[model samples]
Target: MESKEEHYSHDHIMESIRNLSENDAKTFLNLIYALLRDNTLPSEQLVSHVLSVYEKKIPRVVKTRQNK
Candidate 1:
């Protein structure tokens, strides 16, 4: 059986992908398409890669105060 730790890691990876830049996300999707032609692709890897890209670009800042 799959462990909860595995599940959580998978979920976190997907969340990172959701945070990816639009262009990066689209490019990864296209890569998936090209790579999966007549074959099975590992979605988790693709999603994780997308998220890794996001992690590089997304700042950790939660908020900024300017005119507030």
Candidate 2:
């Protein structure tokens, strides 16, 4: 049995992904494609979920007015 501490949580995985260089990212994506090809992952729904999570994390910009 694996303890929670032994598991790579979503945040840890995301942080690792964020640290990858472009070439590494390409290799990572190729592995994902292979997994998809072998039916190891869900198709478009996974992409949609990732995109939704990414979009929600973007910080909104607010404008401020200055008084003279």
The lDDT leader among the candidates is: 1
Question: After TM-score superposition, what is the CA distance of residue 57 in candidate 2 from its true location, in Å?
Answer: 24
Q: Which residue segments of model 2 deviate by more than 4 Å?
A: 1-5, 40-68
TM-score of 1: 0.41
Q: In model 1, how large is the Cα lDDT of residue 25? A: 63
lDDT by candidate, in order shown? 0.47, 0.45
Model 1 C-alpha lDDT per residue in residues 1-68, reported as the tens digit of each score: 43323323455555656556687667766765665563454888766654544343222211111112
Q: Give the Å error, residue 39, model 1.
A: 4.4
User: Model 2, 1-68: lDDT tens per residue?
Assistant: 43323434467556655655577667656755655566644768767544433332211100011111
Provide TM-scores for the models: 0.41, 0.43
Scored by lDDT, model 1 comes in at 0.47
